[model samples]
Target: MNRTPEPELMQIPSQVRAYADADFSRSDSMVVKSLEKFLKKAGRTLNKNDLIFDMACGPGNIAERIAKNWPFVNVVGIDGSKEMLNEAENRLSLNLTKNLSYELIDINSIASGEIHFPFKADLLVSNSALHHFHDPYCFWGALKKLGKTKCIHIHRDLIRPASDEKAFELKEKHLSNSPEILKKDFYASLKASFTVDEVSQQLVDAGLSQLEVFQVDELYFEIIGCI
Candidate 1:
């Protein structure tokens, strides 16, 4: 299926509220666990000064997880939407987790050199972020700019279905109990996401073929490696 790009920022009030309130804990925890597993397999340990960037971190759920898991490492969650970052900051205030912060950034601007980010990441992670970019290269290009050499990557995103019918079926199957707004966004995201093969070619074109892309399940694919 040809990809249909969704809005890059989740700024709408109702949409943001639904997204922030949704229980994505199962999938969010998986991102952190997968990062730990990969880091161990790579024989790498994060130093106290090491930085982890969670790109397009919608509500900072995953960023909070990483900060809690690696209290010594500095973790920043970057997103374009102020509404989203507000949610993240509110959670941080309640959790009182150290070494974690949120930044209001339009990643495409970074990719376009319109904005300069101050920190480079030792570890860069994102969940369901790539599909937001209409041009996939922008996503990869921004990551290349943000990551230090040999930066570890753990990115998971919805996989585009073969057809709209399939996308609808998957959304209904997985999000049947979700709020209407959440389900609508999920369906749009499914349409926006890329196939594993397409993502692999994107990696190659971005001079990041060291990263491996593979389907992790019916709805998602993971990109993992040092890049």
Candidate 2:
């Protein structure tokens, strides 16, 4: 099947509502669980006062988890979607950490050197957002500039399936209990995602060849390592 990237933002009311209201505890928990393992594999540790950046933080779901898990760390989520940020801010009241906040900025603009963030991040993370970029290198460019000093970075995204059958198989295997909206999104994301080799080449082109690109599951690949 040909790859089709979903819209960058869940702007439509129904789409936004469905996403924000859906229960993603299972999948989101997997991401939170993998965070520690990835960090450990990279030989990185977070401090009590570390500043964490969650790029393309749609609706702040993963950001919320990071903040809650690392209660003393300050978390800032950056996204270009106004609607998504609105939903994220609305949910902040339920957060266990007061340090979590969201910023409305075009992350893709980071490559253009047009946006200036107030702080350099100690840790950078993104969950399932890499496939959304029309130009994946734009994200790498942003990382090169923003994470220039030294930062622990990890990005996880779906891996493109070798065939449509494999895509649907993985979706059903992993998302059988998920809501219809999320199930659909998962399939689309798998189509849009890059293969491990493709992502490795992208890293090389971006001068980030040292980052480890590997398959984490049947349908997921992770780009992890500190720079």
Candidate 3:
């Protein structure tokens, strides 16, 4: 798959991490709900003792949910933004058990062998953050190194149809009932969303032929690969 720059590529500016973290905390519930559904559909099992990594885990919202839902499993949330990490730490403080933790790490630098984690993860997940990758292939390669047993789930906004008219029509038709927050999120996601073919091609290019790629809705796409 040819790497293409996302249309709405936006950086998480250093100054806004705290504010962004709060926003993420509020939206965490929705994210968890969506992810839980996807996890069930993927049918990938996680043992109570399994170690999971939440890459690009802004504010550790998903981490908190996973910890709550599967108390026996270990959940580590990683993000490049320190401010975001602080927010995540604060939010998860009350919920902290031995099984949950957070770290500030850049995905790109990790893939380039500039940094390393102490352990390999059993499952690596990212939500609405994959499109921000400047070089997704590098990230995929890093995930592969983490462990083949890992399952990756990315729930992000998808680009509408290739045709502008089709995209607009679909957006208008389906997004009418979406709340303001969701509408905003949906648009951003659509702008950053990749087509199923695009995602599959990424997997193929990364030599992940066994990967499973699918669309969950008009606005969301998923990729599940096991090494």
Candidate 4:
């Protein structure tokens, strides 16, 4: 099936609200678990000065988890959508999330030299970020600018199904209970996603072949490595 591109930012009020209200704890937890497992294997310990960026972070779900998991390290959730970030901030308490913050940034701007974030990332993580970019190179090019030398990465995204029938089956199988708007968006995202082979080729094209791409399950794929 040919890929269908969705808007990069979740700016619609109803759409953003639906996404923020949806329960993603199950899949979201998987991202944290994978990152922790990866770090343990590498035997790398995070410190106060370490900077962790959650790229294209929507509702800050994964970013919050990482910040709380490692309270000493600074965590910033960067997203292009104000509505999404607002929802993310609503869930954040200054008292509870002292080490956590949000940045309004269009990731593609970094690649174009329009936005220059002063600090480089020690660890950059993104969940459901890659498929949003119409041009995949925009995603990788911006990442290269943001990450420090040897920065650790863990990015997870839905894998495009082989056909529209397969995509619908996966959507209903996974999110049958979700709201109509949420379900619609989820279906669009699944259609917009890339396969493991395509993502692997993208990594090579981006000069990031050091990263490893593998299917995590039927619905998603993970990219992990140091760059």
Quick one: best lDDT, which candidate? 4
> Model 1 — TM-score against the truth?
0.98
List the global CA lDDT of all models.
Answer: 0.93, 0.82, 0.65, 0.94
lDDT tens digits, residues 31-66, model 3? 566666667887866777678888777766777777
C-alpha positional error of residue 218 in candidate 2 after TM-score superposition, expressed in Å: 0.9
The number of clashing residue pairs in each candidate reads: 0, 0, 6, 0
TM per candidate comes to 0.98, 0.89, 0.73, 0.98
Q: After superposition, how far is residue 41 of candidate 2 from its true place, in Å?
A: 5.1
Which has the higher TM-score value, candidate number 1 or candidate number 3? 1
Among residues 3 or more apart in sequence or in different chains, the pairs in candidate 4 whose N, CA or C atoms overlap within 3 Å are none
Candidate number that wins on TM-score, 2 or 4: 4
lDDT-based ranking: 4, 1, 2, 3
Candidate 4 lDDT over residue span 124-152, tens digit each? 99999999999999999999999999899
